[model samples]
Target: MSLKSIFAIPFAKLATKKVYKWANKPFQTQEKVFQKLIADAKQTAFGKDHDFENIKTYEDFKKRVKVSDYEGLKPYVDRIVLGEQDVLWPGKPLYFAKTSGTTSGAKYIPITKESMPTHIKAARNALLFYILEKKDASFVDGKMIFLQGNPVLEDKNGIQLGRLSGIVAHFVPNYLLKNRLPSWETNCIEDWDTKVNAIVDETIDENMTVISGIPSWVQMYFEKLIAKTGKPIAEIFPNFNFFVYGGVNFEPYKNKFESLIGKKIDYVELYPASEGFIAYQDSQTAPGMLLQLNSGIFYEFIPATEFYDENPTRISIKEVRLGVNYVIILNTNAGLWGYNIGDTVEFTSLQPYRIKVTGRIKHFISAFGEHVIGKEVEKALKDSIKDTAINISEFTVAPQVNPESGLPYHEWFIEFENEPENLDDFTQKVDDSMQAQNIYYQDLIAGKVLRTLVIRKVKKGGFHEYMKSIGKFGGQNKIPQLSDNRKIADVLQNFLIE
Candidate 1:
């Protein structure tokens, strides 16, 4: 082992121990964070407007601040964009993470000096936790590549503005500088395809070990590597035994990824966002990511089923229950208060508060009063393909409310890397799994209100084409697992294999 790996092992142990200190007392850590956020921001514009000084409890906070989305917070953000100080946080934000918005064209999420370190530390600690648990730190000696957005930044009123991943690129620890792959010039290449090709050229001969990124985009990179060398990734980089991914669930891509890499490798899931780094997979044996209660953010939970209801019940982390889907809200040091980031999660373990991302608040199929979420569809597909040679490249589901024949149904658009031998049997297996998991869906199917889901074979590269057409082809963008409306389904029709 190299000198770096030798040092990393001990450091990983120390860091992980530090994490356990707070992880062991999740509620207390979160309470401290909550109090600090409220106290520190009380003099800021948002705090004053929300009567933060009078807020002494979670109930007081709920009464003072209304849960808000980006549109609701835009007025304050607009002031900050115009070079105003103390509009949201004290002074001005250190950076603005520019992200694609649903209704708003582009969203600029503030990253304050106080809140920025938590993002970097959380990512680092995730790997350290893995090393500590596995007693392996040798990957630290090999070249590590994180496939991400262009690191190029544009100045916005003296605060740098760029994609969250790009902003993160600037803060890679000095110790890892020698081991990090893809030169800065290559990372700055604006076109993703060109950049990925350049990355392949640069790392083809390196002793690469750790690879990290969204699974879908990494699959694209893996495909490019295989195409260029006529070898699976494992053959190309024998030391590549660790994968770190976030942004989307990895189950649907697992079989395809194994085929690409030619073996199963250790994987770590993260819950990082433009707003904050919320959680990370702390143990290989654990079911969910350990929520970052000690991070510079306070958490709130609103049950997903009641999210759209008027006067929805909002509670603190202490009140959250396992297995219940809740829309996560944030109150951060970066000056976001009662902010809804659109993600819904379920606590998988409550002892130390571990959560699994269930779905997005807006990404669900409820066209027929049956709220089928991303987790259900993903689980159903995952279960159906078990003990088979089937490999799925990508998939998405949408309601087919006005079908030409019989009853309405859910339409699943799937791109297969390896097609099942019997398509009809496979479809039945998936439908059966879906019905078993969701009582409402089963009820609708039993009542003959909806037929079994129809699977539309999408031509290879169809999802890629759809994303490209929509100007979100790569770098943190992903196809939603399910949608209530026909927006995505209507566009997908053009790519269906007839």
Candidate 2:
């Protein structure tokens, strides 16, 4: 082993021990973080506006500070953008992690100096935990590539602004600089297709061991590597063994990734966002990611069922239960207060506060009151193809409210790597699985209010084409798993199989 890998062994153990201290005392750790956030920000504009000085308990916090989305907090963020100090947090944010927003154009999320290290630390701890569990730090000696946005930043009101991944890119430790791939010039290329091509050229013959990125984008890179080398990724980079990914569910893409790699390798799932590094998979055998209880953020959860209620029930980590679907809320050192990041999660383990991202709060198909979620649909499809040779590249679901034919039904647009022999049988299997999981969907079908769902085959590379058409072909962009309307389905019609 190289000196780096040899040194990583003891460091991994030390880091993981610190993680367990907080993980074992989750409630206490979170309460401490809660107290600190309120105490530190009491003099800031948001803190004062929300009556933080008198907020001594979680009850006081809920009553004084209301749950808010980006729009509700944008007023304070607007002032901060003009270089106002102590508007949200104290002083000014070190940077603004810019991300695409649906209705608000680009969103500028603040990253304070106090909160910045949490991002870096959590990412490092994720790998360190893996090394501790698997007893393997050999990958550290080999080249590592994280397919991320360009590290270039633009100045906005004296604060640097860039994509969250790009901002994080700037903070990569000096020790790993030589091991990271796709040199600076290639990363700065504006177009994704050209960038991927450049990445392929740069790393084609390198001793790459770890490849990380969003799954769909990584698949593109894998395809290019296979095409150019006439070999699976395993053969192209014989040392390649670790895959790191975030942003979306990996179950649907697992089979495709295995096929591309031509072998099963270790995988790590992360739950990082612009707001904070929330969680990461600590063990390969664990059901979900270990929540960062001692991170510079305090957490709250509102039941998904009651999220739309005027007075939704919000609770702290002390009251959360396993298997309940909740919309996660955040109050952080970055100055966000009761902020809804739109993600829905379910607790898999309460002892250490482990959670799995189920879906987005707004990304669901409830047109017929079935309230079908991203997790449900992904599970349904997974169940249908289990123990089979079938492979799916990508998919999305939408309600077909007004069909030309008989009754309205859910439409699943799937891009397949390996199609089932009997399309009708496969469709029926998926429909049956959906019915088994959701009572409302089953009732609708039995009541004759809606017919069984239909699957529309998307042409090869169709999703890629659609993404390119919308100018979001790559770099941290993801297709919503389900939509209430046909906005995506309408555009997908052009790519459907004849």
Q: Which stretches of candidate 2 lie over 4 Å from their true place?
A: none
Candidate 2 vs. true structure, TM-score: 0.99
lDDT of 2 by residue, 1-498 (tens): 989899898999899998898889888898899999999999999998889999999999999999998899999999999989999899999999998887898999999999999999999999999888878899988888989998999999899999999999899899999999889899899899999999999999899988999999999999999999899999998888889999999998899899999998999999999999999999899899999988899999999999999898899999999989999999998999999999999999987889999999999998989999989999998988888888999999999999998999999999999999999999999999999999999999999989999999999999999999888988689999899999999999999989
- Candidates in order, TM-scores: namely 0.99, 0.99
Worst window of 10 by summed lDDT in candidate 1: 468-477
* Candidate 1 lDDT score at position 169: 96
Residue 87, candidate 2: how far off, in angstroms?
A: 0.7
RMSD of each: 0.9, 0.7
Number of clashes found in candidate 2: 0
Q: How many pairs of residues collide in each model?
A: 0, 0
Q: Against the unseen true structure, what C-alpha lDDT does each candidate score?
A: 0.93, 0.93
Clash-forming residue pairs, model 2: none
